[model samples]
Target: MQYTAMLDFRTCFDARKDIASLLKQEQSSGVDTGADTGVPRQVRVLGQERDGAVLYTWSDVSPYRQDDVVVSHIGLYEPISKVNTVLFVHEKLVNLVNCTVNQERTLLGFTTQEKAATSSSGSPSWHSEGRHHAQVYRSYLAEVQPANRVFYLNIERDNYLMVQFLHGKGQGYGDTSSKESHMLFLIHKELIGLYHMKLSRVGYSGVEMCGQPRTEVLAKRFQWAQWDHQRQRLYYLSQKKKNSNSKMTFTCMQFYEKHPPEVMMEVQVRIYLPPEVSKAPSTYEHLPLSKKVTDQKLLCEVMTLPGGSLCICYQHPIMNPDDHHGQEEDIGEYDVVDIEYSVFMLHRGTALHCCMPGFARLEAVNIKLHFFPFSE
Candidate 1:
């Protein structure tokens, strides 16, 4: 009803019988019919079919550009032979149905009447601020190449449940023209158990198979840590300990954190062990190489700044290759010492800066200060 009033279009249909009856009544009064003929021609209208459902054309308006338009529709039906006789369905109901059918997102749980009720009452309701607008939940996903940097993500209040999955090049499932496929999953609060079980079982596709829900009101504070030291640095630089004038070449890694403006970000950094120390033990040695590689990790927070840079420090011993922090007893005869630095991040749908190799002199080095949210 509000949409019809706002658009100011007469797209509703009046019953043929009612129009005929009205015309006959006007004719009996000797009123001229020539002027009345053009009244119906100005309005773009549609009528109910023989099956009793009214068909109408609908358009999905683009928020960014006015010219970018999409056309779709919705239909409504009423049961015949009703005593109450509220009569035919109105255009406003048809518009509401069209919005739902066309996937034009609105408030997830709250209804139009509920929102109106809260507005009328002037209460601090759940649908306050930008929650009532579909634009608030807008999400964008893109594709990126694998590299070595940490990603700082800031999840919006209710948009966390909108899980998005993207397929890389050659992983197309639906559209051929697209090099990647994207899918969104909305998990409800009540269905979280099922969601968790599915996620633990088969990853994101499990959420897709569980239910194709449009929106879910699932909001809960979650704190967790993940280790992703799977990627290894390909090549590392080593300088002779005795050479004082040796050139130091460092590999630089750039990272980006894409998030909505003004949101705080938290990131976990995972640095893989340097290549030299990670090498297998010599064949003549009695001890074999340890299968597990210990990774050094740190937690960092980012503030409202849109973009920032970070650097990890690499420490190599000059006097003693096996000496680390004066802990000489832990070094074995066959052990080789090395210093390495690496980084990783997820942008669009690709992993970046996962494995970069660099070497530096031994010292108690601090990471770049600006990388953290707060600096001392």
Candidate 2:
């Protein structure tokens, strides 16, 4: 569970040397090593890691500028097979990389550059447009494998969302094998798109759509979201404004294959702020005034606790506007500032319920709060 050593370029170079020596020995013994057939000569190593005893090295085909590193050609070095497979050779730049929870597949997000076309008059014309793409590749060591395009996204080029992969049993998607299924989730602001791709032993069920892609647009912007793969649930918190008051609403959504996703539970609680404190200003000329505070500002965060409970922590800043009206001369002398914080837990069972009054406190200085998930 803990890392004993860091894997770097040196590790890859050392592994490559060992593999080269092994290959030379096999060749000398008249052994047929057909795995390394079409590896290129020039490649710069980017990253390398080991899965079990097999070493996987990622490299770029062409030399790149140190100021602007744009990865166009990607390759993978397999030590066991003695093969350096080219994963992708693109005309554009690859910007994002994400691996599945099982670390068997890697998702690369990149942009396609617009190619110049020849005009009717024999002049070159630029398209002035580009596209965004996401491609999945097999990261584990294999005999000879090529990258696959699971699905294509039509999102705008400028709006790049982080791609997340979830692998589990496809309950109602006609997948009966014990092999886990693969699905991808992309979040763009308040919109969440879920795409299902069943990965077979050989490869994935090609680029054809397995099922209709599911999308959910929330009413309000959410702070963060957490997915529970075991229970097949998604939880998020959004804030709703009612007149001059605001309340945080927590929602849980359940996913299914045939039926539409449904909300399993929702809870809303009004945020309460402590009373503002007022103090007489001192006549000290050297004192400095406190920074101006907003009328009623609320900061909220959510974390998942152990035993399937949700913990929400929020802070409210209390400031007195009337005390600053005539005290501009002695603003630095008044020392009355407070911030109130509250923490509560929501438990789920046959029926969702909120635990009894949780902890609340007021402090003079603003305290940075960090909530540890699944910690005792």
Candidate 3:
């Protein structure tokens, strides 16, 4: 609920560069500086409690931008190596800047763009004339086409997942036309896997299938989605129309390189209101003539907690104002009402549905919910 500031973006960037330079100097001279160097190191503490525990704080600063380069994403890389590194992604490059204390190393960078334009004959341009010798050979996984722009990037060890948007020729960022498609790429070292999907007025549809037709099991646009890097699983909430009523379902899915996404578990979302809020009052004379009690639910947001828990905020109608009421009918119906926001935690199966780390099984658990009241 509360946050404290620690390091800013500019400070972190400069510290990483300084550490990297120190490591390079020691490597060339074959010297172990250690504690003898008398240099102060940067310390980062995270996720500590207040009661007899070290309270580490982190602050989020705006992305660093210089000249034509704009940082699109910034995150701490998974601790696969001995050195702690901060990851930075821009339109054309990915940089892993070391941020370790006394121990430091050179920065790692990768170009995420393709060189040389396509010829007018629709053939490979690199093979023609004098361009063949000048062409820079790069892996398929590292090359992102000029037409596509990365919208999301997630890195876990050697695996990289990038979601790109194929935009029009003159379209800017976040601008999408009807013909645009979203491309999902998963790269493990040199190997590349791709999943392409297009959004239509109805829902989402796959642009290509592996072997057989999969039209029946395709899902619509996700209402909410969260990815768990540790488990390599993705959890999402979607709505399904059953006859006249619509139902929401929470699903756990996993992605594979050679195959399509695998569905792990699915459960219908159910919310049970408290008895006090669900029941209507017996007296109606004190209420406005143009208003009545109604039971309607509206979803606000869905987010994942730290310990693999999910939280949902929604609003339930306690009193509904009649839209058909005329201005001359009653002035009390237009009176301003005070809104109340309340927070409560409910158990799964009884109120919400959640999946556990055990994978296949669905457990009944408690989830926190925030409710907001509305008059209209």
Candidate 4:
């Protein structure tokens, strides 16, 4: 059987195995920055970050001389929406998992393969632009703080990841339904050394096999509209009809506001054959045509939205590498962008596991899902 050339699948055995393997491997070859060392087994511990040390350089950061190395707190989001988590259990099969992480509207890790697939008249190919890298998304989560933004960050698996739990027990079971504890991934870098990261959660709605009672968030109420005046903001009202009193505060941002003006120039000439019009205007804003462009054939082609009445305008992302248009997948996809994110809900499960004193049980929580993939 072919195995993943980059990593050893038999990873994470025990701390003794991890330290012993590290020392053994270090003795033969010194661990240098950017050096590709063999992955060690049992590389994780109950309360430590491992992935941080693996993705970036572990350089000992110098004292602040610039005093301006700012860490911008950005809300990274999916290029499109995601519905399910792809749990990774195999190593060699990484490439087999065909998916579009289109979480950020722009393509990353896509190669020429997916690009060609997206270039057709109806659907242009784009997945082939970025290199195919292993991507993993985990879903089961108990609220650690009762609130978490549903988004993900790309990180290496070999590095130390700090895994926290929902309850203090870290048993990863139940307790106060309210999120209290957390599991973190501590990464290792050659320069920065270690950084802590929290795992992003995905939606798990239909899990009959799990046998536990899972709360279902019936997406019945989703109201959004825009005044489109100078305010440039869109108002949205969403509520859960299945469980009355459950309110959903959803937001969206329209990133394609920078669409190049779609202009159609026409010349108006009343006379059948006017004496050669000899004017070369500096600006061609006004063409000399008046036979109004009314023919449906003359109008640019367009597709109707799902309602069968509304028209949809699909714009491509701006080519600038720095443009946020590339980052408009979730909230940014709306006609307006909001800086504040909030969620307040009151749910009652017809049948939910009531926790026993020291023993907790498996739990499933509902996270709103709206990510839809589109070529950037």
Please give the CA lDDT of all the candidate structures.
Answer: 0.24, 0.40, 0.31, 0.21
Q: Rank all candidate structures by their TM-score, best first, as comma-separated numbers.
A: 2, 3, 1, 4
User: What are the per-model C-alpha RMSD values against the true structure?
Assistant: 26.7, 14.4, 20.7, 27.5
Model 4 has how many clashing residue pairs?
81
In candidate 2 the C-alpha lDDT for residue 258 amounts to: 52
Which number leads on lDDT?
A: 2
Stretches of candidate 4 above 4 Å error? 1-88, 91-215, 218-376
Could you tell me which 10 consecutive residues in candidate 1 have the lowest summed lDDT? 98-107
Give the runs in model 1 whose Cα sits over 4 Å from its true position: 1-117, 127-163, 174-376
For model 2, residues 63-171, the per-residue Cα lDDT tens digits are 3243433344544455565654444444334432332222243333322222234457665543213322232211211111234443345543222233333433443
Pairs in clash, predicted candidate 2: none
Rank order by lDDT, top first? 2, 3, 1, 4
What would the C-alpha RMSD of candidate 4 be, to one decimal place?
Answer: 27.5
TM-score of each: 0.19, 0.44, 0.30, 0.17
lDDT of 4 by residue, 111-174 (tens): 0011122234545322212323223212222111222322233333211111121112222222
What does the lDDT read for residue 373 in candidate 4?
Answer: 16
Best by TM-score: 2
Judging by TM-score, tell me the better candidate of 1 and 3.
Answer: 3
Candidate 2 stretches greater than 4 Å from native: 1-145, 150-152, 157-162, 169-189, 197-224, 228-232, 239-244, 256-262, 271-300, 317-336, 348-367, 373-376
